[model samples]
Target chain A: MREFQLIEKIFKPLTKGCDAAQCLADDAAKISLKKNEELVISKDVMVENVHFLSDDGGFKIASKLLRVNLSDLAASGATPLYYMLGFSKTKDCDEKFLREFARGLKSVQDEFDLCLIGGDTVRSQEKFFSVTIFGKVKKWQILSRNQAKEGDLIFVSGTIGDAFIGFTKACESMKYFSQRHFFPTPRIELGKQLLAKKLSKCAIDISDGLLADLRHICHASKLDAEVFLTKIPFSIHAQKILKQVQDGGRVCSHPELVSGSKFTTLDLLSHGDDYELIFAVNPKNRKKILHLAKSLKLDLTCIGEFKKSTQKKFEVVLRNEKNQKIKIKKFGYEHF
Target chain B: MREFQLIEKIFKPLTKGCDAAQCLADDAAKISLKKNEELVISKDVMVENVHFLSDDGGFKIASKLLRVNLSDLAASGATPLYYMLGFSKTKDCDEKFLREFARGLKSVQDEFDLCLIGGDTVRSQEKFFSVTIFGKVKKWQILSRNQAKEGDLIFVSGTIGDAFIGFTKACESMKYFSQRHFFPTPRIELGKQLLAKKLSKCAIDISDGLLADLRHICHASKLDAEVFLTKIPFSIHAQKILKQVQDGGRVCSHPELVSGSKFTTLDLLSHGDDYELIFAVNPKNRKKILHLAKSLKLDLTCIGEFKKSTQKKFEVVLRNEKNQKIKIKKFGYEHF
Candidate 1:
């Protein structure tokens, strides 16, 4: 199908009820904010083989792309409003692929109450999708990473390392792992609850793993952090995988893991794509946060705390269950 | 350089002095809109070896990407504010290329009084750049293509077909053509003047060639348009190229043009990449618009008028100087 046909037949319907979209006919979209509201925006790009397998269906690829971008807004404590997509379709992306992609987008947009606004669609040899999301938050209420105060208790929502294990298992035809790897919850409600209840003012999403993202907060706040390995939350599946590796069982078949190296629990802490929210809260508000978490039915774990740093360079210390500092190399994934 | 180092050493400097950018430290950027103001947003993506030559320098590629996206905001009569960029770099994009790209972005951002707010940088096998730009316009003042009325005079800013000629000549190492093809002026001020003075309420930027873009307005407004070939403004260089093609001179060396076919004037009207503004104005405001154009030192041509369409599918008729209708096979470039 031609670009216009794909837009008219598949993408245009996604903007049906959005008056601001202007039926996707205008050159650009116009949006208005309430008097006391401010706009929050973020963009994320995903390549075909680098980010997802080429054989992955459009639905899975589209869902992961939108979810990761939504995670950014969730970290900012903003409500999702709209999104603009830039898709460069490869030769293999036919009408069926586009239809499924649009369906996936519609599913997420319906769940988040956001609509498509404007974007560009083109053809390329290598397929990649980029999304720019716009959300709204109360004036002066944006939660930033630099707001972490000294002596603040650190917390992370949901299970960690599941995505890493899921990625490994998915490569071996594991459905559960594939599902976990592809469909991540963005924690939008928890983000808003934390800000609205004044429970926390500092937060970052765990896209680049726990330690690396925590270091981002520490670096921004000009402080240091200490995280206990035992306190880090892990799912039943991830724990089983860790046990198998520790018991001299078959290690992960991933190229990076199987190349003359043993797979260890530390690998879980350093791998990314978890999409969970890690935040800092005042010690006084700890009970309130836990209570909020119980009401929301989310697993909120207190894994660490922020500390004052005398040195200019901030550091994140990971300690073992025995209370000994664990030496580490390579915090998380780094794209060059 | 690693991704973080590249961002810290190069791209982060582009966010300086933008309070909303948060020193490039946050997951998302926050923006506040004044009362009676609405946000205008647009996105454009350019792929190497497709939208541009792979050998093109970062400065030229960066400038063209921003300019094309800015043209969308110009069509909506919006004032530039902020932008988010998503770039996928190939192995060939070294530190020098990134520095040059940043420099080009700084040049345009300074001239346009805008700043980079947030973006993502990642690695890819094929390089591509996507930009999402944000601007502001007064409430109820956005120029929409669907607002054109019957008897509205069709107007075009600057010249047409220069970019096509430039594309052709640049393929043969013509410096003048290379400059024209690489750099385009976005008609922001003219769009603002038209809307502020109530001279027009309909406009579409000519990125998809003259007839194709005019058809966009006609399709949106449910009207037909008639453009006279003689009245269509063309630069001296474009005129020379057209004369050469007519006189059977050395035809363009572009692969598409030289493949057992004669390059004609119709190809010029059907080809795209000209970032000029095509708009509609009330006949009564023609003199005022011409006056405004003279003050701005821009050539604004009155090429045609919109007429009521009897059929469902709108048509754009091209008339020769002899008042005879000219047939065109393709309207403009389409990516499929």
Candidate 2:
């Protein structure tokens, strides 16, 4: 279908909220506040070779790019209302390529029902995809990274490591998991529900990974988290990846045992695009929130708890095969 | 001065109509409007090699990209409020390159006091820039090209072809006249005054050139134009460009002789980043509007009048040495 047609048919249904969020089909979208909502805006950059491959399928890259931005929206338990896109044109680009690019934009925008209010397209040697998403939260519903506090329960949605596993397979030319490395979906509904019911106090999406992204909250909130390594979510295919890493001359342990330093396989488990919601919920609302999510088709898991700052007191906690204490060196991924 | 410090200092005084704009410095900007304004958002893309050469100088390219967006805002007579930028990183691109780029951004934003809201940065092989400007105008003051009426007078600021001359010189390595091409101010005060007085009924920015842009207004208004070429205020340097083209090969019996079939010269007038204002003013307001602009230290010239139709008669009236009208071929800038 044509881009406009696709936007109308597939995407227009998603423009929701108070009168502030006008229908998304207009050339320009306007949001007029009915009550109290703070507009949250975030922009993310993904470049070819840096964020994706030039040879990567355009649709996948475009959708994943949108997902990454939407993941940011979920961080605040906000509804993504609008987005602007900036695409760098390449020499090989032409009208047809742009048409397809627009179509792909329509698809993801439609999936989220986001209004493609405005953006820029320009030519460059390498492609850069920058999508800036806008969302809104009632002042009370806003969950900032700095709002995490001690005694708050840390929770993550669904599975982790799938994205990293997919990335590893893509790097190794293992055809089976290439799709996982692309076309990641952001947990938009869950985020909306979280805000709607006041379940999350502070949250962020696992775009960088559980460790790296969680560190953002911890660092900003000045709180520390002790995640039960045994409670770490693993993909159904995680065992296969752990086995592959073990075959690559890395000492391994039973992942369920959570014992010993697992630095070698940490890369496979720590760094990749995971658009799942990572939220901190009040301990009192845990059961109610879990039940609410179940009715809303969202799976929830509590993985850890927050504590006072750990910078002054460093400790490594692990469990042996017999469930006794042992030392585990690495926690997660680092961008630097 | 440091980039952010320069922005913070210089932009402080020029802030316009910001009482309602959600000014988010170093984070994200937001605008919450009550009524009578439909947010107009548009984006344009620029890339090295495709939009400019390596020799274009980084600062000029950066300013030019921003100027184009401001021009878009200027056309709609929208209050140029906030802008978002997207950039690609290359191996050769260091913090130094970025500091200059950010300087250019801050300069433009400060000059117009256009808030730098948010943007994305990524690594790439060739430099690319995409800027999206957001502005708001009253529902009635939202001047669009399609709203011009027959009998409307087409007015533009300053002269048209200077940008083309500066462009040609820059292409030919000529030193002089390059400054005008580098920074064509977005006629902010002129646009706002026009909007406030509701003098400009319909408008489009003259990024394409007077002829082509006028053509667009004529098409959108469902009318044609009877342009008086002699009335146009040609810059002294444009006279030099006209002299060269005429003295070289474009000799004809008519003073308003035609050459350069693609309107490349006029295309430079109309084509890329000239931030001149093109508007259709009601015939009754012509003299008073001109007086008002003069009082504001700005120049406005009426070059053409709208016609009923050009569908059956595409006539180009070139003035002979005696000022008698003679038939000539028609041409203007091309947009794809």
Candidate 3:
């Protein structure tokens, strides 16, 4: 089928009743916001083999691409509204692939209340997908990474290291762990709650590992951070894997999982791909946030605190149970 | 430099005083619209060796990517406001490339009164660029391709065949035509005049050639088109090339320019990459649009008229000076 026909058949339904989309027949899409609301925009690009495995199916690839960008909106405490997808795929991609991809996109759009407004599809040698999401937030309720104060306590929602553990479990064909790596649950409600109730001034969705992303907030706020090693949250599955690595004195039995040798509590904290929310709150708002988390039924863990930085540069200090700093060379992945 | 530092040193200055951009240090950017205004959004993706040559410098590649999306916004009479860029490059792409790319972006943003908002940068095996542009238009002044009515007079802004001519001239090292192909002047003001003055109900940008884009309007509006070959506009450079093709009997001296052997007026109309404006108007509004065009100092040509389609599917009829139908086999480029 031709590009237009493919888009019409597989993608048009994604627009549904959105008048702003113009049924995808116009050169561009139109969207109008209600008064007192501002548009939040973010774009995320994912390339095959780099962002996802070459064997990943269309549904998984599509879900991961959309969810990662949605996580960005979640970081800003914005509601998902509309998005434009720029997709390029090799000739090997066929109608069935597009059908499943569109199905995955539709499912996410329905779940998130987002409409596919406009985008472009082209041919490329490899798969390159970029999602530009436009969401909405009350004018004064928007959150930023630079708003965290020096004396604020840092909090994280949801368990960390599950995605990193999932990456290691992919070799074992552990569907649950692998799926966790593929599909991240963006903390949209938690973010909105933090913003609307003024529970937090600064927040960042964990795309880069916790420590790395925390460094971003601290750097932007001109502060330092102290994270307690025992305070870091990990899923039961991740904990089990970490136990096996330490007790057996072996990282992984599978030869393909060579990166497992790098497994450590610190590595779990530093390995990227955790799409949870890490944020900062004023000390006075701790009780209120705990109550809010319970009411929202979200797992919120306080792992660290921001401190006034004497060097005027951000630094993250990892402390053991005795509050002694540990010597670690690498804290996160660096893309050059 | 790491990703964050790369973005800070190269992309942050593009944000300057735009508070909505969050200084490019946040997860997303925010934009607010004036009362009664709607946002116009469009995305265009360009892949290396497909949309452009692999050897094209960063400045030219960046200009092409941004300008293409701007053309989409101009088709709908939207005033440029802000844009997000999704860029992926191989390991070989260095700081110098980013500096030039950002410079090109800044130049275009300044000329269009738009700001760099938010986006993503990632590493890929090849260069892939996507630009998502957001523009604003008054709700009632917005235009669509589906609004064209039967008996509507068709008008095209500027020349049509320059881009196709430029593609052929690339081998001859002809700067003028090649530059036209590289840098298209989007009819932003003309589109605004047509919509704000209510002179045209429907419009489309000529990207997939004039005939192809005209067909898109007709197909969407449930109408057919009658294009007068002689009335189609052509730039002076394109005219000279066409004269050479007709009189010299030598399509091109360079073997690399063998594609020029396919040169014909019909070929010019059918080829893609002409980023001009094509819109449908009520015949009575002709005098007004002409006056508006004159005042705006833009070249406007009436090349066709939309007619009610009896068979439902749209068709384009190419006519000669004697009003005789011409047998044309192709309309435009279609990506599968």
Better of 2 and 3 by TM-score: 3
Top TM-score prediction, candidate number: 1
> lDDT by residue for model 2 over B1-336, one digit each (tens)?
332333344333323435322232322344455455656666677777666665666677788888877877777777777776665555666555556666677688778767666555555676776666777777656666777787888787877766666654422444444666777777767777787887875777876456666666765567777766577777776666676665563322211224342233434334444568778889999887878777877778887777787573423233434666644333444322
Chain B TM-score (model 3 vs. true structure): 0.94
Off by over 4 Å in 2: A1-38, A94-103, A139-141, A170-176, A247-264, A310-336, B1-30, B34-38, B56-58, B170-176, B248-270, B310-336
Those runs of model 3 whose alpha carbons end farther than 4 Å from true positions after fitting are A170-173, A249-262, B170-173, B248-260
How far does residue B55 in candidate 2 sit from its true spot (Å)?
Answer: 4.0
**lDDT of candidate 1 over A201-304, digit per residue (tens):** 99999998899999999999999999999999998777876887787764565543564345678878888889999999999999998899899999999999
Question: In model 1, where do residues sit more than 4 Å from their true spots?
Answer: A170-174, A254-262, B170-174, B255-262
- The local lDDT score (0 to 100) that residue B200 gets in candidate 1 is 91
TM-score of 1: 0.97
Instruction: Give the CAPRI rating of model 3.
Output: high
Worst 10 residues of 3 chain A by lDDT: A248-257
* Candidates in order: C-alpha RMSD to true structure: 1.6, 7.0, 2.0
Task: List the global CA lDDT of all models.
Answer: 0.87, 0.63, 0.83
TM-score of every candidate relative to the true structure: 0.97, 0.80, 0.96
